[model samples]
Target: MEMVRVVFLTVFMFFVLVTVHEWGHYYFAKRAGILVREFAIGFGPKLFSYKRGETQFTLRLLPFGGYARMAGEDPEMIEIGPGQTIAVRLGQDNKIKNIYLDSLDTRRNVIRGEAEFTDLENELKIRLNVDGEITTYDVNPQAMMIRGSQQTQIAPKDRQFGSKTVGQRAIAILAGPVMNFILAFVLFALHLQMAGIPVENPSYVKIGEVSEGMPAQEAGLKKGDIVVAVDGQTIGGDYKKMITLTSAAKGKEMNWTLKRGEETLSVTMIPRSMEGETGGKVGITPELPTRKAGVGETITKSSKAMVDTTDLIFVGFKQLINKFNMNDISGPVGTFQLTGQIAQQGIQYLTYWAAILSLYLGIFNLLPIPALDGSRLVFLGIEALRGKPVDPAREGMVHFVGFALLFLVMIAVTYNDILRLISG
Candidate 1:
């Protein structure tokens, strides 16, 4: 049951994050007058779908990734061949309102014939042969194409993505990453509000709580006792250094000096090895100073946290590029494992992890790597500079190659994650 809960939480997290990212693109694209054909969560076979206005919303089988499909983004064309039979329903203006490529069992008063020529994007007309006579019919700009059990509205030239101005297109492409950053800010603010903000500096190591039956409790340690030294080495208020020393002790007996109410006392205990962990623990939590945050303080702290996290991420990226290491990179499998571990820690920690992940997603998508938002913006920049867009075929090919390479990298990283799990 615990494993199931972890899996469910992981999937839910992915769904919420990815959907928000894609919705940003979808919403802005619509605002810019571009046709968004589908807003889909996950990939692979469709599980459920529905059409709304001009967009089809779908839930797919896999819970890993998703996309918002804008019209004219793909190079391939959906066409009606010269000899294919099609059925059409006309509206009051005599323009074809619905074109049925298959499953015409429930239609009434519809024209059925073999398609001779079709231009759904620009011309919005179709030539058909009916009873040995050929005639051309105008198609509605918002006509629905029924194929199998799916319906997609036709995207005329003006409504297609490529027809939008460079500024509009860039905004639509950039909105996804922007939304991710916004989500991180909101999550960080909420977390800070719930769990008080930590102190910037500390001058002494104090005990917040002592676990029952743990070494610290057995050694007569109590809450509010300030740890003066360990093994005769003055801690100097460096809690991290103290923790390092204790963790390295690994079941070795050590002497601790504590100050309580102006009286110094000495105690002895051994650090115990913890299960599924790399260090030894005395079960003593640090008494770090923190205070309840007001609304204004929460906003200020959250903004600062976002800036700090972004700087750290960029530094990490720089280091990764300078000293490439497979172990330093993680894929979905590694993330799942980490999520499970953090989920066990409690909701506050999990929320912090999610906020960090959101920041990573936003920053990573802004990298000028092909098939990313940054790359699309780069193309738009070139178009603005040159007064003409780059060849669509060439740009599409570059993105395709980039996507293939990314997939290979994902496979390698996932393999490493599996190996680490098995070895551990």
Candidate 2:
């Protein structure tokens, strides 16, 4: 039962992360006036689906990943040939009715330059270009449907993803990772508030070790003894404060209050006040204390946590590249195992893990690898600079290769995780 519970928790966390990431893309795409065809929470066969506006939101079988399908996001075919003119028609069949190219009438039924024909929300238009003279004819719905045909292809001017400006496309692509960062910040802030954020030091200092024959050891102080107060002054977990008070009170009888576990005891001893290379010698090392944070402090801590986590991710990436540490990488199996362990630690630790994982997802997705948001932004950047979009087919091929390599890397990482699990 415990194992089942762990599995459930792991799956639930994965679902939440993937759904939120996809929702980010959907939200931005909609805001950019692009038509979102589908917003799916997972891959594989659909378990359930519902249509909202023009988008079909679905929950699929696999919980590994999700996607937001925007219209015209996929590659569309375009044909260029030496001809007098070509008639491009938008209909249920996508078949050109006639070809007036080279002034010779020819009837060939072929789907030319297919576009996404999922829905017919726009008018049906047929393009006629004769000797560089271009004209568009808006065919009547009834006339186009005379032979059991309907408008299946969308024009470039329609509210499709490819029709959007480069800036808009970049925003839509970049929004997914941005949402993950925001989610991480919110989670971290909540965890800090509930768990009482850890401060530098709290209200007492612990004696780590005492040198024999020294004042602290001779006065009966020992390791693990927490100094609560010295000479009526509360140390309040400040080890430095206790040292300063001891230094000033050299040669005077000092009163010490120590907390040994649940019990407190008092001890008195006189300092030697000897001058040495190591300043005033208390002959005892202290351990730091943890201070609990309040509301404002928690917020500040959470913000710092976000910034620190981001910096750590970049540093880790640098190390991975420079040191080539494959062991440092974790795949789905390792992540699931870690998630289960965190779940057992309690809600606060689990929340903290969630925040870290969210930040990781956000940063990792921004890597300029193909099939990723960062890669899309890179392409858009090139398009912006070049004053036009790259060929769709070439771009699609590049993403396909990158995705294949990434998939293989994931397989290797999962294998390593399994081997490590079995060996350990």
Candidate 3:
């Protein structure tokens, strides 16, 4: 039952993360006037789908990841200006000739009437007979927008990803990871508000650790047991009050009221004095300080939590690269098992785990690896520097190779996780 709950929670969280990440790309692309073909959660065969506007949103079988497909992203068949009637011909001198367009209105992605075509031979005595106004401009084919897919063909270049400026393209690419970060922030902040921020030493004490054969251990007082009262007097959060009561009743029978796990228990034990300490010894350590936060404090702590978590993730990455310890890594299987373990602890802990995982995912996606947003940004960087885009075929191939390598690594990590589980 517990394992089932964990699996369910993990899958739900995965779906949310992937959807939000992809939606970031979808949102920014739309804002930039680029047509999104699909906003899909998961990969492989689709289980369900719906079309809205120019985008088809889909849910697939795999929960590993998701994607936002924008129109005219491919380098092949660059569309320029509206109008479907296009026929290209080169003269013997290899010059453009007889360009034709079929009444494609740039503003409206519609074709109302026929457009005129002219060749160099008839350039001197050109005849214009059209129902609609005709506007012509010299456009470079190389600079035209690329098509995402041929399914719902818009005016070749009307709302194309390739038509968008480099800055817009960069924002669309970066938005996925940015959304992940935002998710982390919101989750962390909410968790903080509910659970409270930690302090070094809290006045209110819970039994964190109990020494063997000590008074606490003998009384069946376990770790995470909260001491509520002693001898009918509420201890509250005062560690000093707890000590005074215990010290005054040393070697005498004392009734300790405990909130253990989810049950309230009454235990009787005689406190034993240590050699140097004045207070009675129960052989327990202080629980960390924690207090629920207000709205403002929640935001402040959440931001701090994000920064600290990011720093820790970078440190871990550094260790993974430098230490060369493959055993230290955990893939999907390990994460699933960990989720189960944390779920057994409680939902709040599971939520905290989710926040950490979200941050890790956001940071991981920002790494300049192929088939990732970071790599797309790198390609845009090249285009910005070179004043033109790279060959789409080459860029696609690189991403394909990178994806293959990453998939292999995932397989290896998953195998390791399985091995560890079997061995245990």
Candidate 4:
């Protein structure tokens, strides 16, 4: 039964993250006046789908990732072959637009002779007809396009993304990440505020759980023990501080002050290392000892926690960068492993974690980094500065290269995930 619950939790968390992540892109794109073609959750074949307002939404077979499709993605004509004109589809047949290319060579390949179909493909993949479903068209096919087939393709036009003012294009590109950042902050704040957010209070440090047969058990410190102090240093009358002192003193015996049933007594407890990990182990736990509080207290505690947690997240990101290694980034498989651990933690814990993660994911996406919302925003910044939009060919080329690099990084992280699983 526990195993079943774990599986359920893992699946739930995966979906929650994917849903919130994609929704960020979908909502912002619409608000920016971009024509969305699809908003999808997951990858691979579609399992369920529906369409609304010229956008398709789909639930795919692989519950790993999702996307948002948009229109006006191309600005220049694409020459598919030598002396051969390709009829590219920018939209429906009646709404279709076409342009002729100067030559057949890729604008991206101009300096190096390579071609990119990303500007068109990414937009198509994001534009599934409101059913969250997306279709990836093969750009390598060297055949004439049939009528109505161009909706899955991009064409050259002033109405295309290349023609838009830099400010407009910048907003459209940056909006998704901005939405993500906002979602994360709001969700985190609200979640912590709910359930009378727990704060580190200097009250009685009541034990909630205990490790079996550990040094703490030998010392006779049982569950419900209200920790008072350690080594004669007052622990603000809290449980965590008591554990902290003991854990720090691992491999050595320490004096502990605990309140048991209205009786105050000092006992020596040793934190011993436990199997599976290194640390001082005191067989004890922390309890919330919940009480009904007024709205003010609840808000204060919750808001404080949210603010602290938010700061901590950014700190963690910086720390991760400083501690940069192949081990840091987590791809789909890495995320799956996290889900497994969350599974072990149980549903309620995972639910709380999920909400918190949702916000963090949103923020990370919004950072103007390459192949990320932040990076897209950088382009916007450039456009806003130059007063003219970056050349479409050049902009598309940058995104294509960035995306390729991003894919490589993902593969590396996924490889790390596989290694951890094998070693673990």
What would the TM-scores of all predictions be?
A: 0.81, 0.64, 0.69, 0.63
lDDT of 4 by residue, 1-424 (tens): 8877777778876676776666766665566556566788877798998877657789898665677766565332333433233223333332223322333243232111122232332232111121333333333211222323332334323324445566666666555545544554554445444434455454666777676777777878777777777898887646566667777888888888889998987888767887785668776767765555466765576556556767888998999888987777778787877777876854545655765676576677666556676676777778788876667677778878887887788788888899998999
Ranking by lDDT: 1, 3, 2, 4
RMSD of each: 5.1, 11.8, 10.0, 11.4
Lowest lDDT block of 10, candidate 1: 74-83
Ranking by TM-score: 1, 3, 2, 4
How much is the lDDT of residue 99 in candidate 3?
A: 38
Top lDDT model: 1
The lDDT per prediction is 0.88, 0.74, 0.74, 0.61
Mind sharing the TM-score for model 2?
0.64
Residue-wise lDDT of candidate 1 within 26-115, one digit each (tens)? 999999989898899987899999888888899999666678899899953457888999999999999999999887666778999899
Estimate the TM-score for candidate 4.
0.63
Q: Which residue pairs collide in model 1, if any? A: none
lDDT of 2 by residue, 101-123 (tens): 22123424422332222112355
lDDT, candidate 3, equals: 0.74
lDDT of 3 by residue, 159-191 (tens): 678778999999998999899899999999878
lDDT of 4: 0.61
Better of 2 and 3 by TM-score: 3
